[model samples]
Target: MTHALVDSQSLPAELRPYLDGLVRRTLAVCGRHLVSVFAVGSIALQDYRHGRSDVDVTVVADPLIPARALRELAESLAHPALPCPAAGLELVVYGADFVGRPCGAAGYLMDLNTGPMLPNRVSFDPADSADFWYVIDRSIAHQAGRLLYGTAVRQVLAASSERDLYAAMQASVREHAGGEGHLGDNRVLNGCRTVAFCRTGRWLAKREAAQMIATSEQEFRPLIETALHSFQHPRSEALPLPSNDVRTFLAWVGERVDEAATHAGIGDPGSGTYPDG
Candidate 1:
């Protein structure tokens, strides 16, 4: 795999102070119970649109707090604006979802879903439904430098990278597609393809997630038709097409990469594919 070159100094003046303050406040509020806090989602990736994005922050705490309550409280705290340059800000507390919850942000395009009590940032996976793994993987592969909790975040990152991501995807497919809830079966298979591609050095983990996020229901469905055709994986069979058209989707993602590269002072991975998604 190609190691991406990045200049950590690329952080924007607009984001630095806010992100730093977030870390300090989080640790102070949660105190000893706080395991760690890190930045993920769009902000860390530097893809946030000026008027459309909110800083995505995750805090891991002991005693496993209820995410709903945490989200509500956080939203209330940030409701009047947290004195940041971004249009808005939202904080999400992970862990404590018994009956499958919204995977990412409540009203936003992404969710930080994952298992309970563990701390790390991630993306959404229809197959595993573990938002934790998704965020952790994404953080390490693309925008982890934005992380705030130092050692705690580092431990999680080390563990995730130890295993082959393709293997993880296969396990997710077997467990979700061949095992239990079928909501994201087709996604599982596609995830498998993604993992395999990355393993073979054909794709980066960040690029893989971007491709999945960029995939369209109309044109991409046929690609995962066989996997979704089955009833065993009910969830996957039911995933509908995303709202945005292919052109819009690709443009959004393109802007994200450019913004991220600029903010992080990293090379922008050009839009790889925009096939009528």
Candidate 2:
């Protein structure tokens, strides 16, 4: 099995053992088919909190990997089999073919969610309904993902267009406002990040984004500070987040994203896939 050089010194000390085990287990299951394994989200952005954030991973496999191998991989990586050190493990596997192509949408071979307080899900559908999150994730992965075991991320993953990112941000805001996907401090932080992304096309950590927004938009400083505190102290008995205020903030963020999109001449955010270029 070919392996890529990873600068272990750069990663968090707490994550090393778990990541080592993950790579070994994945190699055992996928063998020669494994192309790359990289981490995105907070871990890549250098904002990982042991008890608060999940280890978001994207694994690429050769296009012809068999169904049985996929199943085995899921079972092998599930919590307890290879215990997660963090809150959970959110891992997605995609065929190399899919990553190499320029088409839109999240095409995956398997999506595994396992660890404490997380649902034990193993989905194999390539056309999963939650396309927005995956699309944004791929963009983040391309821009800032930390390689664990594989070829360089940029060389493998196709770059998502600004249009698709704006569409995804819009979908994410809608979900948060409707109380569908993320909740509590996560909802607030997500909104902060979305607003930051709209202004500058860079993805910043939740804390950094919230702090940045709080500086200019002094009116929302209290809300942003509360979310930051809550995120850092996950186990603390914090008061319930102000739901109405959060919703209002998310709606405002949606407006900002729309204005940014219009200014960029990206047109209205739509649900369908657009060209990757």
Candidate 3:
């Protein structure tokens, strides 16, 4: 079993130590045919917080690593125990063929090389970039970009920007929402698209106007409400969230937006300066 560590430059300085140790431990446990390991998600992009996120590490190996082996690998990473809170460490496992398809924003995954029973290298397209503008505009986008893994995770981020990732997310969303109910699928799709476009517009506004938004509410309620209306569902199902659940999700996202802006140190939208007219 050979292991290739992701370059260090891709991870946030704060996450590197934990991630490196975790990778080493994972290798020690899964010494069975562990071909290579790479870094994915936020930390790979160099933008994670010490307390706000989980590290994303991608482990690629021979086919069928078994769920049991994967679980053991997770336990091993914490063998000596990680310094951060126990709740924060998470391990996500995928097949050498896990790079299935690009459904939504997660982008499509394609095989980079051929191998015996499984492929070793794969590519992902995630939404990012100033042109794309969704990367840092949305709170989720901003948070997702902060991930770190392996000994040298930075190399992956060096080749990728938010723009290259735009498709990966789209792919993931589509896959999640797919199935029999056309209306149900479309409803979820609308919500996802609205968020995606809103992030894009927000990015544009910040770039061109030097302000976060125009006609601002404390959050995105107004925009979400407006976009929700664009879907042609009967008024009964029109609110997006079920009547029982709408308020809760909205309130949750509302708080998140406010909190995210504060953390980034973006003061309230600057008041337009004008002489009395």
Candidate 4:
């Protein structure tokens, strides 16, 4: 097995052992079939939080892996010896054929996460029903992702163009907006960032996007600050329950998201397979 060259300091101390085990275990599972693996999300952006972050990884395999190989990979990841120390371990193993495809339906071999408060859950992420956020992930992995092992990120991963990203961001927001419930921080911040990216072609974290947008686009400051305060995780223990203002703000956001979706020409957000329903 090849030892992937990475800045060990980029990962939290508690997660190092788990990451090592993950790499070795994955290599064990796929052997020669494994093409490359990469670090995704906030880690690649160098904005990962120690306890708050999930170890996001993308592993690529030769096309059409056998069921046994997939099972072996999953079992290796869930091994007790490789206990996850952070919020969770999120992994997406894709087939080699996924390269250069839009893959709006991002099927994965293993997509699971275990959190401090949230329970360990394995996702049955069918390609058709996958979340559109994978579009954003694809962009991140291709544009500025840090390599974990094997081939370089840009060489292996296919990136959607800026226009595609805009379409995807709008699609994701439109789905949430049209859905039957209030939008959370994930949706709010994502919506804000989508607007930012549409105008300025930059992918930033929730707070950073909010701050940046609020600067030149002063009209969004109140909504952005509110989203920054609400954050992503549950907050009943720390703050009061949602007020009317929260819902009102999100409603406005929903309208904006829908408008953005229309302008970007991402029609029929509902046409795709949706699992959240």
Best by lDDT: 2
The sequence of per-residue lDDT tens digits that candidate 1 reaches over residues 205-259 is 3334434533643444443453334312222134443323322433333333344
Candidate 2, residue 75: how far the Cα is off, in Å: 0.2
lDDT measured at residue 130 in model 1 versus the true structure, 0 to 100:
44
lDDT of 2 at 102: 51
Model 4, span 203-260: residue lDDT tens: 7766687777667656556766766676644433223323444344445554554555
Error of 1 at 16 (Å): 2.4
lDDT for 16 (candidate 3):
57
Q: Give the per-residue Cα lDDT of candidate 4 at 180.
A: 46
Model 2 regions more than 4 Å off: 1-5, 235-239, 271-277
Model 3: residues >4 Å from true position, as ranges? 1-4, 66-68, 85-87, 100-194, 197-277
After superposition, candidate 4 runs with Cα above 4 Å error: 1-5, 12-14, 79-81, 123-128, 161-164, 178-183, 217-220, 229-277
* Candidate 1 root-mean-square deviation in Å: 14.9
TM-score of each candidate structure, all chains considered together: 0.40, 0.93, 0.41, 0.78
- Quickly count the clashes in candidate 4: 0
Question: What local lDDT does model 2 show for residue 273?
Answer: 28
* Reference-based TM-score, model 4: 0.78
- Each prediction's whole-model lDDT (CA): 0.40, 0.84, 0.37, 0.64
Better of 1 and 2 by lDDT: 2
